[model samples]
Target: MSTAIFRFYEELNDFIAPERRRCEFTCVLARAATAKHMIEALGVPHTEVELVLVNGESVGFERVLDDGDRVAVYPKFESLDVSPLLRVREHPLRVTRFVADAHLGGLARLLRMAGFDTLYDNHFADDEIERLAGVERRIVLTRDRELLKRRTITHGCYVRALKPPQQLREVVDRLDLAGSAQPFTRCLTCNAPLRAIAKADVVERLPPAVREQHTRFSTCDVCRRVYWEGSHWLRMRALLETLGC
Candidate 1:
């Protein structure tokens, strides 16, 4: 029986039981296994892995694991660049688009408020979410471990937090998206891109005082929902800041 040493780094540690973090683990293999297989077997989703170092050389998911291999896996980097060090595989897709599972509506709203293209619906079945992510190439974000385990899911995250704020932080940090976050760029009520609209265009829909006090206005391209820099925007901005966006 051949064995390998695996060490998961950074947020990937969250998938492991507390007792296993920052420690070398011995995994025995009865047959040849790709790095990808061993990684998921250890509970880290393949989508969350950005870099894999075998011994000291960078390799891709298909890299075969061998006896005595010292494997180190890391999540997406938030500050550091390792492009020059990669032996194979390209830099991770940096687009902030996401597709969420049914149980995470609040977290979905938070992501939308933070200006992410988050596709969410309470009625989405696990298979539908997986299919959408596969077809659209959106990063699947779900709390369901079984959903993340689906082989069809090429890009996905098994959200670790129940609280919406914590889940937001976990996604931001895991994807190294802090630098790309754009708060208030999307309609909070709808996932449509907000465009600046003249006050006169939406005046008919606004309250008398709202039209009188708020000159600046925006509209959702998809939903035609109106927006302005009101108390709600301020509260959302506060939430964004609290999220370290």
Candidate 2:
């Protein structure tokens, strides 16, 4: 049987079984396998890997594994420039859209508030979230480590923070989305882009004071929700600024 040694770094160790945690582990196989396959065999999903080094040489996911090969795997590095060590894919996407699991409704709302296309539905099952992520090419944001470990998920991230606001910043920083911030341009209630609407068109829907006090307006194309710069807008802007968006 052919065998290889693999050592996962950082949070990746969370996926390995208790017996193999935090150290090099041996995998016995009948024949050569791709680095991606070997990684998934070790319980970490291929999506979680940003780079792989085999025998001190950078190798792509499709690289064939050889007997006695020592593989080093790294999880996504939020602050590191890994372009030089990229194995299979080119540099990771600078801005990544997200699909949050049902439990992250608040985070989804925060992402939406930040003008991101965040897909969220409380009734969606974990499997459904994974499928939608694959189909829509969205990154999976989930608190469930087991769900992130699935082999089918090609792009997934395990959010480290529990608070919704912190989770939003975590996602943005992790995905290098600081430069892509476009605040107040999306519908927070639905993942729809907001369009400028004339004040007179939506006047009847607004409160008397809102109509009298504000002239600039934007409306959600999908939900038809009207929006105006009000007291809450300043609070949201402050939060966004604090998050480095």
Candidate 3:
């Protein structure tokens, strides 16, 4: 058996057991193993790892483990630039589109409300989410660590927050999306961009009071749902304000 000491940094430690978190721990490799497999075996998905160092030298996931080697792993650096070093993924996702798993319905709605291009269906299977994320280049947001471990999923995140509201804050802060928030610009239900429409065109669909009181309106291009600056809109704005977005 070969042994190596592993240290996970920052949020990467969240995946480890309480005893192993925030410190170096020895991993006994039964046989020859790649860094990727060994790291996943320790509960940290390779997707969440931005950098891996073997004995102070930058190495890729395919690096072969050796006895007495020291390994260090790090989470994605949102602010700090590690351009001079090697990153596990080919490139960072510049456009912040997202695909939420079945369990993240409320978080998906919140993302759409913030005007992000979020694709979500409660019936989406794990494989389907992986395929969509890989083919469409959408970042997968899920609570399942194993889902992020799929080799096909190049971009994904493990949502640490439990509540939908807290999850929204977590995602926003993690993605640095506060400046990009365009509230009321997307369909909360359909994930389609909202377009300004003439109040006269959608008047028949609106309630009598809404038609009489609200002149400005927007409609979802896909769902055709009408929206106006009503009480709900005001309440949503208040929510956004509370979120600092």
Candidate 4:
């Protein structure tokens, strides 16, 4: 057995025991335990960890824990430059696509409104979500810590906020998504990229007021839904502006 001192920083404390939070605590470990094993053993999903240090030296999750070792685990560094440190994942996902769990439908739509490729289906099961995320190389956005803990999920985030708008803000800040956001470019209902359509092409489907007043429009390639810069669009745009995207 090995005894190691562990300290988790920032929001990571949310996953640990109240007595162990924001302070060093001793953990008894099996001989040759890896940092990954120890971290998951404490209930913090490995996907949420951006960097880990053992004895003040940067190390990967597979690094072996030693007796009296001091382990400091940190969540994703939104503003900090830790390129010199050892990160668990080899590289970040470039496209930033996401698959939200069944419960985060509101957030999924909001993400779509922000022009992110967000996949959301109210019927998506945990297994389906996991499989889709892996195949599509999508970042899992979910509130279920247990789901995020799965080994197959190499990239994911546990959303901390409760309300949809707050959750969107949290994700935007945590993932540094504001800069990448391209608002109103995706179909909110189906998650498809919208292509500009000639007003004449969709004019028959538009409401009388929309047909007379609106000359610009876009449509979902997947669901064939028409989109226009109407009152709803203005309202949604205002909301996204408040989020600074």
Q: Which lDDT value does model 2 have at 29?
A: 53
Question: Per-residue error at 144 for model 1, in Å?
Answer: 2.7
Model 2 C-alpha lDDT per residue in residues 1-245, reported as the tens digit of each score: 78999889988888888888778889885466889877887788777788899999988888999899999999887677777665555444455788999889999988888888899999989889888876777889898877876756767888888999889888887777777888888899988999999998998899999988999999998899998889988788899999788
Clashing pairs in 3: none
Residue pairs with backbone atoms closer than 3 Å in model 4 (clashes): none
Q: Kindly report the root-mean-square deviation of model 1 from the true structure over all alpha carbons.
A: 2.6
Best-fitting candidate, scored by lDDT: 4
Q: Model 4, range 141-179, lDDT digits (tens) per residue? A: 999999998889999989989999899999998888888
lDDT of each: 0.83, 0.84, 0.91, 0.92
State residue 221's C-alpha deviation in candidate 4, in Å: 1.9
Kindly give the number of clashing pairs for every candidate: 0, 0, 0, 0
Off by over 4 Å in 2: 1-3, 17-33, 90-95, 149-152
Candidate 3, residues 14-81: lDDT per residue as tens digits? 89899999999998975889899999999998888999999999899889999999999999788898
TM-score of each: 0.85, 0.85, 0.94, 0.97
lDDT, residue 234, model 2: 78
Higher-ranked by lDDT: 1 or 4: 4
RMSD of 2: 2.7
Per TM-score, the best of the predicted structures is 4
Better of 2 and 4 by lDDT: 4
The residue-by-residue lDDT of candidate 1 on 144-228, one tens digit each, is 6667767777677778889998898888877767778887788866798888988878999998889888999988988888888
Q: Once model 3 is optimally superposed onto the true structure by TM-score, how far is the C-alpha of residue 84 displaced, in angstroms? A: 2.3
